[model samples]
Target: MAPTAKPLRLLAHDADDLAVLSAALQDAVAKIGDIRWDAQARTLTMACNRFRWEAAKGKSGERVRSALQFGDVAGVQARNLRRDAKGAVVELLSMGFEPAEEAPAGVVTLTFAGGGDMRVSVDCLDVALADVSEPWTTPRTPGHAD
Candidate 1:
């Protein structure tokens, strides 16, 4: 008999942005689920509470597992960025984010599953975004979360 397989959990910032995760990434995900984006409001809504992982040993050898959030939606900087599917560098706004000059192109929204539990650390948690390419073949880790 074939082994049980998982479903894909596809996520993206927008239509032009690349999709994170490989075919394996997709296969590992149970499902892509739903995604909602509000470019004007700069808000995103996603259903990502369904993904789960098997219990594993922690540093202390104790069983540990987290019901991590696995999805998000974000907006593209309409001013500095040009909507192109070719995967080129564009200007990402850094005004509301930080003192940086601008964000690279081909990035808008980012979804991360590697970092620890999502916490509000103005210095750490906020600076964990990345520049995503079309189909998300590559991820340029951004300095922070705007």
Candidate 2:
């Protein structure tokens, strides 16, 4: 029998923590599964397939469905948030936090490869990553720019 993948849950507390989370999420490819915001809860959640990073010997490429949640969210501004984005492949390029003028929290931006961006204004940096499935291989070869 194949070994079952263990679910992962990661939290971010500050800018540094966010950076770590960002690194883990880098190069992740996914179709925007769900975009949800709760006014009362002050949270924004986006679900997607996150390329799994592993250190297992001989393992090449892998990916797993995952959800990323942002808490203390004051608001969410997104470009190209549509049904078409539901199944279209998107890659997370980078993530950054911009300090707010008055609010203790700041804006966290998630930029994708195809110009799709989601900015979350939060009371504080609160991010969570949870894996939803077992990883499967997607072989890749290293490339070098000349």
Candidate 3:
């Protein structure tokens, strides 16, 4: 059964704000084909099925379709990814930022499981995450070993 909840809409304009968004996006899974980097548009966007940590009440949980986007992206670099394999799926673990030499400009790193990660150089911190569809129940809530 669907919970009585509103879809999440968020924006990250600073590191603190991004930390909140990063937490919300933790454990989101997506296909490589759903990730896009538009050089001309200076944006990086990804469509993900995000585990709804906010809505996770006890063991009951859900996954919702979400769109994560970054603006003013100067460039992007990836590691440990099979870019050639469009069907490859990735689970996002966390997102962090390192400030550049200039103020407001920084590199945002998206770390995935198994050491795969993407580093995005940005003109400034500009990001948005929004849930686009109704959530469906998941079989289990995510767990991590200490």
Candidate 4:
């Protein structure tokens, strides 16, 4: 019998923790419209269909709906991304944090496959990732040339 997997939930309070979240989110895809920022709440969130790299084994794979969120966001900026193209999809490559000279305050960059990026400037490192639904079968796993 195949091994069973459980729902994943993670909280990132610092750079080291964020690295784990980044790995879990690698190859995740999201629609432009699914990404949202609420200025009043100082939060940024994205609903993503994330490749289940952690649970994946052998030839078969799948993706799970997940929510990635950042709190205490001071501002958000995008580069090489078209917010107007709501239907467009972006594949997440990786994520990293650049510390601000002021200490806990810093920028969290979400790098996409097609040279697109979204930077969230935050008051501190505060992020969460959680699988929101059951995984669905995927015939092909994501591949990279490198």
- lDDT tens per residue, model 3, 1-146: 25676899999989999999999999999999999999999999999999999889787799999999999999999999878888999999999999999989999999998889999999999999999999999978888779
- Over 36-69, each residue of candidate 2 has an lDDT whose tens digit, in order, gives 7888988888777666565233536566778888
Models ranked on lDDT: 4, 3, 2, 1
* Prediction 2 TM-score vs. true: 0.79
Q: Report the lDDT tens digits of candidate 4 across residue range 95-139.
A: 999999998999999999989999999999999999899898898
List per-candidate RMSD values in Å. Answer: 15.2, 3.2, 1.3, 1.8
> Candidate 2: lDDT of 1?
11
lDDT of candidate 2?
0.75
In model 2, the clashing pairs are none
CA lDDT of each candidate? 0.24, 0.75, 0.94, 0.94
Clashes in each model (backbone N, CA, C under 3 Å)?
13, 0, 0, 0
Off by over 4 Å in 1: 1-33, 54-146
Candidate 3, residue 88: how far the Cα is off, in Å: 0.9
TM-score of every prediction relative to native: 0.23, 0.79, 0.96, 0.96
lDDT value, residue 144 of candidate 3: 79
Candidate that beats the other on lDDT, 2 or 3, i.e. the better one: 3
Candidate 4 weakest lDDT stretch, 10 residues = 1-10
Off by over 4 Å in 2: 1-6, 56-59, 80-85, 141-146
* C-alpha lDDT of residue 39 in model 3: 100
**lDDT winner, 2 or 4:** 4
